[model samples]
Target: MTTLDLDFVRSHFSAFNEPSLAGWSFFENAGGSYACNQVIDRLTNYYRKTKLQPFHPFPASEQAGREMDAAINNLAAYLNVDEDEIDLGPSTSQNTYVLAQAFLSIMQAGDEVIVTNQDHEANSGAWRRLTDRGIIVREWRVDPETGYLDIAKLDKLLNDKTRLVTFPHCSNIMAHVNPVAEISAKAHAVGAKVVVDGVSYAGHGFPDVDALGADVYLFSLYKTYGPHQGLMVVRKDTREALGSQGHFFNEGLVHKRLVPAGPDHAQVAASSGVTEYFDAVHAHHFGPQADASKRGPDIHDLFQAHEQVLMAPLLEYIRSRNDVRLLGPENPEERAPTISMITNRDGRSVAEDLSKHGIMAAGGHFYSHRLFQGLNLDPEAGALRVSFVHYTSPADIQKLLKAMDAVL
Candidate 1:
């Protein structure tokens, strides 16, 4: 099997060689990754050459419209979803907020929606707020000790009245990869729709939405090393079921329906760069391929294999430490590269100390306050999160281990 070419991977991201960023090991990728040159070039070119009112009957406008359409089509192909099923919006928080409005129009009083504490506030708060409209918002809480969501608990919560179930593909803090297909299957059996927040998971690999079987899937492009846009896929049946949130004229357009705010043409156009980066990776390892869908899994496995190797030593180190509590599974195979730890010392101070040695990481509740409270962690103190992606090298991990030793 072909392995990931790390040299080929790091070369695509200009940030690695920046004068000010030299020698700095970036582990805050879950917050947002350093964009690849493909994204930067596309974004910059869009602004310079094709900045115009897209879809208009003119030269620049036509080019702008084509670029935006290519972005959606290419990305949709990679996910194995129809282009019409995809919606690009400002951010994941904004996308879910708008989507909640559509759900509100359909859900009747006494109907239940289950949300997980393991989710970021972007996914949890929006659905929970629907309780104001008389919908019964139920909490599918995570295990207080392990920070893992139990499907058995979810099974108890689902019933005839359960209209929707919202959870993460993986938690930003816990990093445990959820069984999205299995969870979606259970929800489907209960006649409920599954809304997946893929922001954390997509940084490791973009999912095959069709196979995952979610009614609605969402991820942020910025965190995926693309533009700052939220990409959502609403299955055809789910799109038709929800009331339109867009303007009256766009009611019949599946892509336009949930986006109340008009699309950002330039950013949408630049998003094609994400697929460009993926294609480059696929070609470098496995040779040129015309099929984006086929390439998706191959590339995903390659990246995950590389990440797991780098993640193993870090997981072992965290498990051996008695001074801090590791948040999720100690095995790297069970999670993404996003690792969190709660310490006796202040998390923020530890993060600051790590920064002095040029290790870029973050410390916070990460907007999952309810999850923190459930885990018996002080939300005010939060926890230290050290996350990375495929571009991260073994040498970088060594620097992080040394910095962590000195700081903690």
Candidate 2:
């Protein structure tokens, strides 16, 4: 695979050149990423030219509809799934909540579903509520020391009665990249479907959703250099068995089945910019491909290769520190670049100290309070998070280390 061109990648994000954002290294990417220039330009263009309702015969309306369709198709191509299998909702929280209702529709009083402490609340909360409906909600917990969900533990949790299994592709706090394909295979053998939450993982690079073999996949577009939209991919085969949460009139449409609320028009239309941006990066590094779908794995490798390099020095620095405790896998290769540490002070105060040195980071439970509880830590205090993605440069990492020396 071709190496990632950092300067070229940085050029695609306007935030790097923004006056107020200058001199600051961003480490809060797990919260949300800076939208690339393509997404931004598409957003502004939509607002300026096609502010009208879409799919009508009038020019602006027709153009608006075209953009929206293109967005879905292009994004689907990159995800390696059918166009109708994709749903773009308001956010991951909303998408998962409505989806749980669909799951509930197909479930019985004593049906069993599995959940995890290692997942963000968006992925865990709505499903947990099924307990009120008489569904057996079993907890597949993380290893407190590693903050990772063990596949062996999942094996123990799985049996003939297992209906569904929901877990994160990577933990936001620990950053351990779960073996999704392996987990999916185990779940399938027990006649269960797996909902893989790719929110914390997708931003680093878009995985081959089809290859992961998940029955359903979810991720946040806002964190993937696109608009504030949540993407849910319900495979053609799996969605056939699930119930719809959409309007009775729209039950025929697969994409509309899970999204109960109306989508944001401009945001949906502008989302094509994400694929456009990815195409540019691919062309820059590995030249052109006839299909964007084919580029998913290669692009994933390119981005992850770059990110792993960025992770090396920081992991080394954290290893040398006696005062700092790094959560998740110690090896950068085993996890995402989202590093969280617990120190003497509370996470918030330490984040405040780091901010004084122009390092952009935050400290909080980050909606993984259950994971903290599993680890015997105070959710209110939380851990300081310093995360980065492919766009993060060596200079930015160095800047962070220099500030770490001062603050820690």
Alpha-carbon TM-score of each model against the true structure: 0.99, 0.99
TM-score attained by model 2 = 0.99
Q: Give the Cα error of residue 90 in candidate 1, in Å.
A: 0.2
Per-residue lDDT tens digits for candidate 2, residues 2-94, read: 788999999999999999998899999999999999999999999999988898999999999999999999999999998999999999999
Error of 1 at 184 (Å): 0.7
- Worst lDDT run of 10 residues, candidate 1, spans 342-351
Residue 70's lDDT within candidate 2 is 97
Candidate 2 regions exceeding 4 Å error are: none
Question: Model 1, stretches more than 4 Å misplaced?
Answer: none
- Tell me the number of clashing residue pairs for each predicted model: 0, 0
RMSD of 2: 0.9
Question: On residues 116-220, what C-alpha lDDT tens digit does candidate 1 reach at each position?
Answer: 999999999999999889999999999999999999999899999999999999999999999999999999998999999999999898889999999999999
- TM-score, prediction 1: 0.99
